[model samples]
Target: MSGDLDLELDPHAVGERVQARLDEVERAGGPAARAAADDAVRELMLLHQVALTRLLHGLTALPGTAAALPGLAADELVGGLLALYDLHPVPLADRVAAALPRVAGKLGREVALLGVDADGVAHVALTASGCGGGCGGSGAAAAEALTRAVQQAAPEVVEVRVQERAAPAPLLQIGRRDAGVPA
Candidate 1:
C-alpha cells in the first residue's frame, strides 16, 4: 500500500520537473532555443493532459474526491500556464482597434501608388503602364473599379457600414454576432 502511494505521487513530481524545464527553455532565445522550447512545451502539455485525465478518473472512482482535487478551474489552470509564457487572449475589438492605424497606412499607400486624390473618392491603377486602358475613368467608375479589383485581390475583406466616429480613420469591428448576445 505504501509503495502504491509512492508510485501514485511520482507523476506529480515528474510534471513539476517538466514544467520547470519548460520555463527555462522558454527564457532562452534563438533557433535552437525555439526547438528546445517547443519540445518542453509539448512535454508539459502532454503531462498536464495526462494528470487531468488521471484526476478525473480518480474523482469518478471516489465520489467526494472531485471536490478536493485542486479547486482550480480548467480555464484558470490554462490561463496561468499561458501567462508563465507571456501569452494571453486579446479581445477582437482591441485587436481591431490596434490594427486600425496599420490598415489606414496601407490604404494611404495604395491610394498614393495609384496616383489617386484622397478627396473621399477611390481609384485603381495597374502596376504596368497602359494596362486596362490606364484607368482613364470617372471618379465613381474608378472607385467601383478599384473596389472590384481590391475584392478580387483579397476576397476575405468586405465593406460594411459602421457607426461614425470623430476620428478621420475608420475603425474595424471584428467578432461574431449572435442574436441577443452582447458583442
Candidate 2:
C-alpha cells in the first residue's frame, strides 16, 4: 500500500488471489486450522486498516494537499483504494462511466453506461461492434465483465444489470402467395 511500492497493484486481482489461498486452506485443513487462519487474516487486516487510516490522515494534513486529490484519484491502483475507502474525489456514477471503455476493451465490444439507478444498480448496455457476439463475448460474459469493471471503479455500486435485448425478428416471412394456384 506504500506510495513507493510497485505501481502495478491491482486490488481486485490481489483480493482474488488471497481468497483462493483462503479457500485452499479451508479445503485442506481442519476446522481449528481454518479458524486460526481466519483470525490471523482478520487481525492482519485490522492492523493494516489502522495504518492506512493514519497514513491518509497524515497525508491530508500536509500543506497544499487539497490540490492533489483529483490527481491521486485518477491513478488506477490508488484510485481503486480510495474508492474502496470512500475517499475518491469523483462521484460513483462518474467512476462507473469512466470504466466503460475498459469494460468494452476487455469484452471486445462497445458498452454504454445506461445509468445508475436509485438502488445503486448500474445499468450497462453491451452492443456489438458489427460482428455481433462472434467478435466479442456472449451476453452473460459481457454482464460479468461489466459487473467486475464497474464494481472495481465504483465500490459503491451494489449491483450491475446489463440491459436485456429483445429477440431478433425472423429473417424471412412465409404466407399464402396471391391466394391462387402457382403459375
Candidate 3:
C-alpha cells in the first residue's frame, strides 16, 4: 500500500470483527483448510508471544521502567496486548478493584468487589437505589457497565456476578420500645 490508512479502531469492535472473521473462516473452509488456517494462527501467536516477551524484558531493563510500566499497561491497545501476553503490570485483583469506582460513579450506587472466585467469576456487590423486592437494582445499563469495566481491566475473569447487598433496616421504627420501667 502506498499510504497508511487513517482510521481509529475501537478495541471491542476490533474484537468482534476478528471473531466474525474467525467464524467465517471456520464455516467456509473444509477440514484441511481449517486445519491449515488454525495452524498458521497458532504459529503466528507463538511467534508474537516470544517477541512480546523479549520486548517486555528489554523495556523493563531500561533505567526507569518501574515508573513507566503502569502507564503503558493502562493504555487500551497496549493494555490489551500486555494482558494477552500475560505481561500486565497490575495483579488481576487490583485491576478488578480499580474498575469498580467508575461503575459506581455512573450508577450512583455502592459497588464492591467481593472477590474473584476459583472459577474465574468476579464477585461484585452493588447496593442499588432500587425500590423493594421486585426491583433489579440499577437495572441493565449499570450491570452492563460493571461487566465491561471489570472485564476490560481484568480479562481473566470469565464472569462478573453482581450481588445486591441487603440495605440496612430503617432507623426510625414505629413499634414501641421494648418493656422498660422508665417508659
* Winner by TM-score: 3
Least well predicted 10-residue stretch by lDDT in candidate 2: 164-173
121-146 per-residue lDDT for model 1 (tens digits): 22323222122333334334444444
How far is 58's C-alpha from truth in model 3 (Å)? 0.8
Give per-model TM-scores: 0.25, 0.59, 0.80
lDDT of 2 by residue, 1-183 (tens): 676996666776898998888888888997777888999998986776677778878888999886787788787777767765666778888889999998788777668888999888999887654554475777887788889888877877999998855444458977777857775
Which residue pairs overlap in candidate 3's backbone? none
lDDT of 3 by residue, 14-123 (tens): 87887777777878886677777778878998899899999889988999996799998887777877877788888878999999998888777789999988888999
Instruction: Please tell me which model should have the higher TM-score, number 1 or number 2.
Output: 2
The list of candidate 1 runs beyond 4 A from truth reads 1-29, 66-183
Name the TM-score of candidate 3. Answer: 0.80
Estimate every model's Cα lDDT from 0 to 1: 0.42, 0.79, 0.81
Q: Alpha carbon lDDT of residue 182, candidate 2?
A: 75
lDDT of 2 at 166: 40
Model 2 off-target regions past 4 Å? Answer: 1-6, 101-121, 125-145, 155-159, 165-183
Cα error, residue 151 of model 1, in Å, equals 34
Q: How do all the candidates rank in terms of lDDT, highest first?
A: 3, 2, 1
